[model samples]
Target: MGEAIGILGGGQLGLMLAESLDRLGRDTVIVEPDPDAPCSTRRGNVLAARFDDANALQIFFSRVEVATFDSENLPSMPLAPFAGRLVPSLEVLRVSQDRALEKTFLAKHGFRPVKHAVVPRGADVRAAALAFGLPAIAKSTLGGYDGKGQHRLTTPADVAAMPADAPGGWVLEEVLSLETELSCVVARDGANAFTFPVFENLHQHHILDLTVLPARVDPALQQEARAVALGVARALDVKGLLTVEFFVGTGRDGVRALYVNELAPRVHNSGHVTRQACTVSQFDALARILSGVPLNEPRLHTGGWCMGQLLGDVWLAQGRDGGPLDLSAWRDFPDVVDVYVYGKRHARPNRKMGHFVVRADDATTAAERARAFRARLMGR
Candidate 1:
């Protein structure tokens, strides 16, 4: 009968958060629409209902002391009734869910973001594309992640092929040549905050492929990135976790610059390595904050580490007739520290199902070993 924490959106992130809460001797209630969501299967107290379901929210809020969401895309208006208990606040979610709003918020707060234009619903995509010029990215203002709801407009033909039923507004951004993509995760309570080390992230087909801890970027850039992340958390008055992803590249002035790419209002995929490499995992940190525990700064525990995502492609390679993955090869690589499978029943391309971490004396070796292990898992 201890404090029970309620989580909106029962995906893998919720599952991981539930695990952290359990270890801290707290109870968890997961509210999710899909019965097969990873958290639904793994947790005991689950409310199988849509996030916006009125009756579900009533029943769920009655059981928990505090509530948080795993994803930012949930309709904020529907959760207004429970505003008193939701951490990070609905205002934060509202801003994070819309690309246009997110960009404007950053710019208004004196943070630099990529130059962009907003194409409101029913607006002319062609006009917006022309204004932004070719080689721009057209992204739906809401409900898209991992490269979904996005298009690369390199030619007039591409713009002409725009989807007529764009569900929401759109943001057209000028494409910038990038040196690297980096992310920093910050956990906060009302009065204090802690930031994880900046991580250099690698993406393949717009999906996260690898994350290197202690990013090999200039030490000065790393410090600045962390500072920016902390500033964002403070500005939002966040009570959970906020992850700021940045693009490190040359600006129009030909000087190296850092621009905020986007913000994730919950534990981020890039912070997965913290579970193995830091004194406190991002999940644990958020769980503690929600449970009324004071925030603690997370310190790197390993020399270097790499987190490799296990996408649905790994399952598809099983050829349907193949059995479970042959994980015996892991025995040969002592540096591969942890393997986590989400227990999802089926896998489709680009869907994240699991992840693994590799530790070594340096970032390069850790990345190489992680990639080699992933290739072996795929039988490549």
Candidate 2:
């Protein structure tokens, strides 16, 4: 077994993965640009360097047996030379980095995706708007996340108002008035792969607000989504976790169509619940795959649910200019609520400083308690 693993991105997801690695008796070396990143604060021996630097990554990759990323934005070309195991390989990155390419790839496989056009450099945005109609979205082909680098145009005027830099090498798509946004998280080791239950995602202001367990879709749709996800994993020859986001709604012709919205070539925000809800987690799955181990059949041991992404503005600390935002405040709550605080240096607006998850037997109770706990954690 590989003794050490190197992770490329040091967000809260990486923080949780670090803890999982420690529990598995494995060491983690996180390479991030921020010296005071929260993951580094809790985990020792983190290398504060840019993931895009070739020489730095070569040196960093030399020490570890395997490499994985918390997110997909890392430059895949530079790391292609690294000898260590890299999950969701460069081919995956090639297909996923460009929305236009991913959609074309999906369509080639007879999988339906939203109709989109590549806005390659100074193309008529108005033409795309005319083709796709109003209520379309212009999205950057790369480096976009958490609803960033995206423009929702409701009219021709909105299309005209697009930033000059925005239309360059981006994608324009006809926005579907969808019923809901859902994500399917799956892990593969080339031969054998395992998939988790679908997550019915709720977004508030373009940011994920909550994820409901065992998606509310019918069995047929759920199966379609899973099969599509597995096809994507296998087609890309992914060796680790892959999160595929989909838009679920009926088309103008009155037929149910699942449009793949985006793809994350690593562990995703929506899958954070697997830590407490499933016997094997995305991180653990990745670890086994990178180490040449077989995939484990996922078993949901308990009927548990998790809520995360607690905003920093709402979380406070004691004697640090702000009052106490201690977990001890929720001592009365059930132990099912797992608190994970990223040891970040600062708590700025919209910064994901930490997350707390509470599991329960049923959906209603879990939602109620999670909201209640969020209220208390923020001193609301």
Candidate 3:
């Protein structure tokens, strides 16, 4: 076998990344503590150790030629030994890991983000939030995703009701008049770079529910979105994949414009539609990039593609609990091209279990079909 690649986390993203590596005949060793993580089924390939296990990392480093992380939440200090071999570099992880740092970085680079103020831990959350002004949100600076670690303050009372101490401090953002959300996945290998079709994403309760492309926006806005994504990748000088999420809304200036929302310096949930929409999926692109394979720009197929996330709630609704979901219903929707289950050990509300892709003649049709399909899946 050829040299192996190491992954820091073994969740669904890691599983998909491993599958991509497998196609390149590259072995993957993952250091993840969760015995029931999505990649746990890989058995011997998994270290089944904590991220900070120095001894396990020594063993892990010895077996791999290169390393990449699936999640930025992994402690960077533990992986210091393999810093030289870390793909995408550790700086990307550091800057993207904390919301405050990320926002400051963006603003420094002249990218407009929602205006806000940072409230340090142990400080007054309510007073700080009110200072940023009422009708805002306070998000913990670290380890928050899928709508977690967020508190909305629409009134002074709401701000006063906020927790006294935020675990990682907080970034309070003035609420904008939201129009829609969009994302662009940018992949790079040194001098070469590629951008996938800009994806228009729809979130429910702060969790992404569906993503469709080409985004149903003005052609100019789509172009601008892609340009901004590239600019972000260029600014960071990152070597792997970066998915930049954007908000199109009425900004504090009272003009509808695009603002950087957040950054995911790895394969993102929003990019899963690439598996069917483009010649090169996001996972495949990252796999090749990390493996030192040359890349040709991916060509988009002539159709609309929509990826609908299947959260754990769907499992409970189907009466499976933690068991395998009933895929018997898939045969009913021809447009539903693919279904991916993460092989998770349990099912609970809002946890992303898998996603499915639908293809149609246009973006609207594809999104409509995807929503209808999931609705039927939930009903039956």
Candidate 4:
């Protein structure tokens, strides 16, 4: 048997990661709070222990050669004793766990980012809003993702009434009138790092809807985005998979530039397309890193492919009528559809139940097929 790999979270990402590990002829054990989690169903060696349970986590860590995380919730203090054994170190998670610190780090590195300010309780929220400007975004600096802990600030009154329950305070950022959003997912071991092509992302209500590889953007802007993302990885001394989200803004003069929006210290949702479209999947890099293997650059496989998500809202209604609805018709699109269900017990509004990856002959075909897939699920 090969070295045992330990994963910190038990989400869809963990499920996919374990699958990737199995493909690589490796062994893995997942530690999660939910005993009946989706990931455990996929990988049998799952430990149903909350990650914050230090004693249990320590015991779990002792059995693995190295560890990585599926989400950013895991902190370093608990994983420190296994320093060299952690694929992405504590500093990477520490800087990424808080949005404020992430934005500050980017700005200090000369990367263009939306103007932002931190807003905590008993602080002048209105004054902070004024700095970022109207139509700003107020988000919790920590423990937020997929549009949660995030709100739009359209006016001064909106800022004054900021939610007191926000985590790690809040970060107010000027809303960029962006042309589109793009993301670059890359991987790094201790010494070498590699980047994949930029993927254009479409978000509906702050949740990822579709991702197009080799995003339709100016070549110069794409290069800049790649550079900025790779630079961030280096600065953080990150290992394993890292993803950076950017806003592609079009100036009044019609020129385009990239602005850093956020970072994911682990494999990202945008990178889901990589599984079928890229020369090397992010999970492969992650496996290589933890197994003490050198990292190789991921190449775009024939201009790459596009991946779209089929959100839960498409099949179920809200309130009293909401529950697990059948998706038997989904299997019909085998030609263009690569459906991945999370196996979640309950379906909620806007929750990411699963995603589909469609590889068309070209970007246009890929995008159209993706849209058609979404429409079919919605009975359009």
Name the runs in model 4 displaced over 4 angstroms. Answer: 42-44, 120-122, 250-256, 317-337
Q: For residues 115-219, what per-residue lDDT tens digits would candidate 1 score against the true structure?
A: 889899998888879877888899999998999999999998999897844657789988878999999999998777899989999999999999998798999
**Which should have the higher lDDT, number 1 or number 2?**
1
Whole-structure CA lDDT of model 3: 0.88
- By summed lDDT, the worst window of 10 consecutive residues in model 2 runs over 316-325
User: TM-score, each model?
Assistant: 0.97, 0.90, 0.97, 0.90
What is the C-alpha lDDT profile of model 3 across 9-74, one tens digit per residue? Answer: 999999999999999999999988998789999999999899889999999999998888888887
Question: For candidate 2, lDDT tens digit of each residue in 149-237?
Answer: 89998877887788755522678777676997888888887688778877778776687766666666787888888888888877777
Pairs of residues clashing in candidate 4: none
Tens-digit lDDT string for candidate 4 (282-317): 877777777777777888777436788866676563
Off by over 4 Å in 1: 251-255, 320-324
Candidate 1 clash pair list: none
Clash number for candidate 4: 0
Q: Candidate 2 deviates by what RMSD?
A: 2.7
Better of 2 and 3 by lDDT: 3
lDDT of 3 at 171: 93
Candidate lDDT scores, in order, read 0.88, 0.73, 0.88, 0.78
Say which prediction, candidate 2 or candidate 3, comes out ahead on TM-score.
3
